[model samples]
Target: MASNSEQKIPTMSRQAAEALIAEKMGPDRVPRKFKIITDTSDFFRVDYNDVVILGDNPYWVKRYEKEGRFGLDDEPKYWVRRAIDLSDGSTKILKLVFHEEFETKIGGISIRCFRSPKKEARILDLVAEHPNFMHGHWVLDSAGNNVRILEFIPGPRYDQLIIDYGTDHQDYFFNYFKEVLDQYIELVTAIKFLHDHGEKHGDIRRDHIIHDRECKVNRWIDFDYNYMHGESMFGFDLQGLGNILIFLTGRGDVLVPELYQQQREVFDRLWGEDLNISYKNRVANLQKIFPYIPKSLNRILLHFSIGAKIFYETTDQMLFDLAKARADVIKLSGRTS
Candidate 1:
């Protein structure tokens, strides 16, 4: 971590930013805004998390100013904020999670709550160990408390990205979906590695994954849901993959038959019979979307699509199998080359 002296973040007053937005975008266009959910006048000169700013409403600018910037002591137990990262000089920011101090008794011993401190320490240590987490994160200094920050992965959610691209570049859907498949492969490999270390990433959501320029190589975010292997698989890894596989493949509105088969079996066993029914129904619609995908590639994608759920049960097994498959494919291609 860089010293705070080496990293200086420019803080702008809410009034100044609002004025600039209003001036440049035109008075007719309502500037992006947020709502203030809590009182924060006691601590700081300013506090962003005290208010939830909605891009549609700018009315809270005045409210935030009136509330003033409350310091760290004023933050709630569950407050999270997206702020500028002081580690690097880059404009990239990170999301910080903060919690209030707690006290309790455990094993007949009095234990002061160190939830915030412990969580930050864990994330910082994780980032240090994982190459994928090398950038865009840090822990913040709180007033006699612990604060944790995660790299603010920039980009729309995968579903939103697909929707945006589909609307603007409908012709590129085929190639884009293929690229997303490659991304899934990379993500699974990383997750497999983590699971190998007995770590479980509890929260795996599209929105949590970022698509920054650097992310194409290695992508994802949100370490809070991460836990140990003994916890839970969260409805099988592949089912989660299948759910997004449909969306990533431009079947966002449905599920493809090949991919649907794998999803039905795993999710049905994990979530319930209802999910399997949903998968089948969705796959029915997907068959129509990719009528033109080459039969061979379609088979391959379909295999992985469902296989994600079944094979992900053991990270080691999945990694070994995937590596072997890649090697076999490489040898065959080598002979041709």
Candidate 2:
């Protein structure tokens, strides 16, 4: 790791930072505009004008500040920029590291979580040649902090596509449904390959999967989340996967707002227990609401329901059911409704 004790991070005054962060986490207060710090040094020249500031997700910035890790700069040191690699003139993602901490519950399991850039760097090396993962190189910046130089994949994020086409549920269902399911299988299979190699994606949001338009494949990004799952090592990720399945299969959630558009009979007939256990508020009962969704696939979703007695422990196990659902649903989807 290179050292640049001389390279100072921009930060807010302790009192000011405390107040600003309090507003960020507070229930009632609206936050004021704050400066976002940008890093543009080293072997790569960051496009300073285009830098994007992504804050510590689990809210560890406050602690880092309390510990004097972020002493008196205008903002947090962690940020990303599109940079031109001075050596080869190739553009790459320059990701600055900032440690974070938090906790979340998945399937009744308490999982302690934090940033693990080293693990992500190692996985980047592991998937350097793999098509489904973004190619990246890790280096220590002049400040002795880890920096990831990533090959940027160009395309819409998976989540955006879901949200877009899913507006017309029937059209999305008939035209894109099978293809989405197939792509999801490929994604999970890629994840299973990582698990087989004794690694975890750690974070698995729908947005993390980017559809590489030129290559026509979904590429996974941002694997920095490292968590402590008690019994099932990949429990948190599995929950995320299940959530994605719910979103994809249902062709978007039919929540309270959408319910107003439906017949009063339709709205009144549904019950809370019929909704997904993990995401109760925003979505509805797919099996009941959309009876066209095959039971084969609907049964698989039940594991994430309130009445579930078992949860998927592994990607391979989830894939087994997915394969079965794929076969049944594809066959059922062929018929006239």
Candidate 3:
């Protein structure tokens, strides 16, 4: 969730904002009439010229043209433009054509993933009112390319909060972690909702989760990816969720080498077989970093760790483990969650 420093962003009056919005948005043209394609199976078969425009347009905000700080947005970022809806003065994003794909493997499961703008557009419609998703609609641009008009959700990202938590680590763990786990349950459940509907959140990342403080949701964003898989179809999405769990339960990650520089004896003691899994050169096992970490939860983290045996088959399995761990930890803490 977002910290209390949200007021750092400035605001302006309605009249002035409207004037600026109109000034930025030049002359309006009649939007081309076309059938908005919601069906993903026939997405590629649609004619380009006939499907030129599918939704309303907004005026571009030129200032964010150069770059956007504090986002997971990868570049050649000119494809992503900010805009203001003249009708309501609400901020929106105009995403243009930027398709890319790759082949990757996680837990011996092969994943063939590609950017699916049409799929994303369809998902926007699906989760239009769902609090956990960033709301948007798809439009066909003048060039007949799939363009997205996304509502701008402003706040520091959940990953940012992970780095910026100001209190004692132990305090965050014993006191606040139960709530985060609850939130994670909500997130995992939301993902399951998508799966049950024959859809997937292809691009799930720690940075993609926005903490909309007012609505009090860790909203997921950027779902342009689609994939084909065999048995573990949701492997990529599950991996992303596992990454989030690791970050949350571990209270960020520990750099054992850094700790070694400070305390050689402690590092030496933590160097043996039961030491936490070192992920990306950092120790991911909260149990090793803070031995107070409960075994039930640490076991889940071990699956995401190096050389772990078990893997979660479904989101339901993950939820079950998370619930069990939360119960064990809450009981150990002697606190009601």
Candidate 1: TM-score? 0.49
TM-score of each: 0.49, 0.73, 0.76
What does candidate 3's lDDT look like per residue over 179-278, in tens digits?
7778888999999989888888986777788899877788998888888866888876887888788888767756667878986766776643333333
Considering TM-score, which of the candidate structures 1 and 3 is the better prediction for this target? Answer: 3
Candidate 1 lDDT tens digits, 151-252: 445544444556655443244443344455556667766666655654544445454455665445445555454322223453344434444544554435
Regions more than 4 Å wrong, model 1? 1-46, 49-78, 85-124, 129-144, 151-154, 164-174, 214-218, 226-238, 255-311, 315-337
What is the overall TM-score of model 3 with all chains considered together?
0.76
Q: Which lDDT tens digits does candidate 2 get at residues 1-337?
A: 2222334443334345434445544434323433333333432333232222221111111111111111353343335555433233345666667577887665455678888778878899888778888877776543456766677788877767876774576777766788788889988898888888988889787767889998988999888879876778887778778888888887666675567576566667667666677666544357676777777788778777766678899998999999988887678658422
Top lDDT hit: 3
- Where is the poorest 10-residue window by lDDT in model 2? 58-67
Regions of model 2 farther than 4 Å from truth: 1-78, 105-110, 260-263, 335-337
Worst 10 residues of 1 by lDDT: 59-68
